[model samples]
Target: MRRGLKISLVTLTGAALTLSASACGGKKAETGGGGDDKKTLKVGLAFDIGGRGDQSFNDSAAAGLDRVKKDLNIQTEEISAKPDEPDADKESRLRLLATKGYNPIIGVGFAYTNSINKVAKAFPNTKFLVVDADQCKVEGTNVLGACFSEEQGSFLVGAAAALKSKTGTIGFIGGVNVPLIHKFQAGYEAGAKAAKPGIKVLPAKYLTEPPNFDGFKNPALGTEAAKGQLDKNADVIYHAAGGAGIGVINTVGAAKKLAIGVDSDQYNLPAVAPVKEQILTSMVKRVDLSVFDFVESVSKGTFQAGTKKYDLSNDGVGYATSGGKVDDIKAKLDQFKADIVSGKIKVPTK
Candidate 1:
């Protein structure tokens, strides 16, 4: 249930900042220093287009940072921008953090690719962690990127969905149509196909580009999309649309059909609570794991600069157990999980 964040990349400008990775989840406490030291590992975040508290990607990443701040008693500064915000505004936020000496500023999605590239290059000495990065570089002082094997996770989710579906129809709703989101759709479709052979997996996106990830931030729109899918006779729907997915889940709530989640455990989020039992399950992408992993590395003085990818191979992403409603189908779901984890089965992307 780890490694679900996608890596977004950008320019060659390097900046100066420290990267602090947490060792565990949600607010670790502070420990006394051995020397006369007030070492503050200040970390900054550039949230995905949906911003924070969407019960998804941004939230998962924040969960990890929040853990580090609480448990390690380290100073933390967080800034969340709206999905509709301009690129320049996002860049300005990054710049402001840099000026304030936030080290190892992390950009949560590909949308911040250019902003991170420019920021990192401008402050060459600052280290950056771009989750779901695209081979981004800031010259010498930076380590690299980190990513997840979404395909593997998506496959497992698809398989599980298929195993539980009784209507032979399912749906996938994505925030945008980028390769990252597309991969989720592809894997889901493949899984459904695998389980039922002829199962119908409908794939849709809220945006085409530019505001791709923004699609997830609009609840009204998400609800409308889910309603449409349900009307098409799909009893189950999976959402990879940041905040938009919540909207989709809400629609499923009203319609009484089943829904699936992505990024984090929706069962833990208030927005999706009403439909908790109906949430079938989630395709968990452990953004929190990656964030805290980085923090732990930083705490141990083992922090490095560069890109790190987490996938099924590295337990970066996987499926959530049923919201407990699909007990009748757990056997198939468990088998799917085992096959994927043991490499005996592979979920296709293409």
Candidate 2:
């Protein structure tokens, strides 16, 4: 819990964050009274690419915030990210929240690694949670690292694809080609191979790389990648792309093929309700659960530092069974889950 980011610190203010929030999504007014002894908790969130409504990662974090806001009577503020926003902007956003006296500010993705590290050092009292990024290495009683075993979840979905695929061929699409996304691809490929020995797993394609991270948002790139895989006779495809996953699902449905979704349950998403049946399953990374856990701890004054690893054993990451598309293979999938949890199956990280 004592890791640190080596970047220099920067100061941010409430006015700056208010303006940014307004420019991105209309800001929500803080509801609690401005008093030192107020019972209301002040919470802040800085969302990654695709923000709240991309029907994916950011939305999952928002779900946690929304639930706590209602259940705990807390005052909350949220901000979204612009494509290619520099690290300085992320630091400013975090600083804005902490400077305004919000406790336990959470950054929604790994992109906030550097900023969180630098900012956590400056504001030693406010809690900071970084989801999906372990490299931030922020160590202190106030910083929490909420990371997931994405590969473990992806492996489950990949097994489903293999079990259900009539074509013995499948594909994978990733948002970026970093170690993080590579973990997704490796686990997926391993799961498919484990389920169906010698199955033809197509080479994974990435939408973009760092400094050009639109791969997480642009559905067009997802569609193009999925189409290529489908053209190669891939009947089932799994994607670890964030918002871009919308296009992957659409293309799969149009071609009457099967798909595996990431982050939130795509089948349950209202935006993709019409094509829900097309999604056989989703690698449900429980960002909501993690966020809620942090919120509860802070509220109870039990805030702790260090990384909380969400793996198959903790039910932190798993494949969704909505739509009953994978019902026939449920028992088999359960066996895989058990084996993974028991450590008999060591899921590859990269």
Candidate 3:
């Protein structure tokens, strides 16, 4: 179970009020001592846009940090990226955490690739981890790149969409036009074609172009894009957008059509509880596992540099079966997964 944003408001004199909020971006409450042998570990997480309550990508990363605090008894600090902030802001965020002695700092998205590389080189002793980026593959560097085979997971959900669609038309919506989201689109198209060669998949829709990443956070954009696809008779749609994907699900579900989620199981997410039944499945990218494993390695004194890959073989990415929506086709989806894992079917990432 993942946690969402928690807000609290306090009343003051004369109808004035104060608001104190705690969430993934908040400083975690310190835990008790471990012992003389247990060295206190401090982790810093820089969340991508949409932050914790996103119910998708960022929340998955936060789940990893939550586990680190619980199992390792460590102090953690989290900072979120602001909408359309400059690269300097990201650098400053990383440097601030490093200066505060947060070792093995993590940047939760590919947007931090350059920032992590620059910061890790300066602070050679403090390790860094960047999700969805492979810039840390240089030898002797103190940074680890956690990359996932997102296309493989997207492939499974794409096949599910093809198998379940009654109208023979499916669609894809991406938050950004970046290469990362391209992988999702490519795999989805490939999988859908493999399942039903005659199935009609609409042209991929993107909410925003590069350098304007509001696509990942803007629900209104998602709503508009999804409505447009629905108007075209797309009965099944898959979205790789982050928080914006909520709009895609809501619009599709309200139309009595099916939608596929990404990153986390949207069916179980509190954000989409109203439309749980409409979510056919999710491309579950295990960002939480990758983040937790990196921190665990650091804690165990076995942290290593270079890229660590997650794919169907290691449960790094796959399709979710929440809401029993995909249960009827689980065997077929599993077969597709097995074929990909066994190198019989290669998923595209372009």
Candidate 4:
């Protein structure tokens, strides 16, 4: 738990994580919160650069927690990522949540991997869940990792993009160029090629370096990238760029360009509510479902530990149901979805 991210944008480093076989192993204790009928569970969430309401991964996680609150009648606390200080604010949020007695704390995205790992050491008794990070060790079996096979979903989305594009040109934008992001890119490329042999995809990264994943927080960059793609006659654009994807949505709205949403249901999240008109469909990853599933496991005595991956085979990661446009490619899109679901098609994870 003493590990820290030396580099600005590097993901959670293994050196920063210290896990012992018996970290989360001990006697089973009874749960007592406020000792009341409500049984209040104060859950904490540390969002990524996109923060909450990004209409993407962060929003999805929040939505999951929201469901937990509704179903379990628990209270929730949240923290936003700061531009000035990264880990300190993240760590402070987690620590404060722990000190305030938020039993189950959840950190959204890989950005919190460092803070969560370090904080996990400080607060051994409190359970935590971290998405997009695998560097931390679970203490007393109280932590969970929420990951996704984004490539699998992106592959299906890519095929849909290729088949649906009347212009025969498509575009893709990623918030960061991490290994996970690369998986989306590789899948998009392969799927597009598979669908249309000579199709051309305009791929652009929000930034050339990893130092600014928060660049996903900047809508201006997303707008510019979308405009660039639209100008090139890309009828449909698929974006995996966190909050930056919101900018893409905005630009698509103004330009009347078709945009493919990512993570959560863009049509449902606040960030995309303003631009629902231009969103063709979204690439859905059940990050929210995974997060809730993790917490529910703790409640059910089946908490899983280690690097668990949620791939298409497990219904953990896949494309979102096409909005009103699912019928636009109805027969074909249905086949693709079923193919992946029924093993008729294997979406590559590379």
Model 2 error, position 104 (Å):
1.4
Model 4: per-residue Cα lDDT over 183-219, one tens digit each: 7887787777877888889855554356766556667
Candidate order by lDDT, decreasing, is 3, 2, 1, 4
Give me the displacement of residue 213 in model 3, in angstroms.
0.7
Choose 1 or 2, whichever is better by TM-score.
2
| Candidate 2 Cα errors over 4 Å, as ranges | 1-40
Pairs that collide, model 4: 3-16, 23-140, 24-139, 24-140, 24-141, 175-241, 216-244
Q: Estimate each model's TM-score.
A: 0.82, 0.88, 0.89, 0.80
- Which runs in model 3 stand beyond 4 Å of their true positions? 1-38, 134-140
Candidates sorted on TM-score, descending: 3, 2, 1, 4
Q: Name the best candidate (by lDDT).
A: 3
* Candidate models: Cα lDDT each: 0.70, 0.81, 0.83, 0.69
lDDT for each residue of candidate 1 in 166-208, tens digit (9 for 90 to 100)? 7888888877767777778878887777778878786564443
Kindly indicate the candidate among 1 and 4 with the higher TM-score. Answer: 1
Candidate 2 worst ten-residue window by lDDT: 1-10
**Whole-structure CA lDDT of model 4:** 0.69
Q: What is the lDDT of residue 58 in candidate 3?
A: 97
| TM-score: model 3 vs. ground truth | 0.89
- Candidate 2 colliding pairs: 1-139, 2-139, 3-139
Query: Alpha carbon lDDT of residue 135, candidate 2?
Result: 52
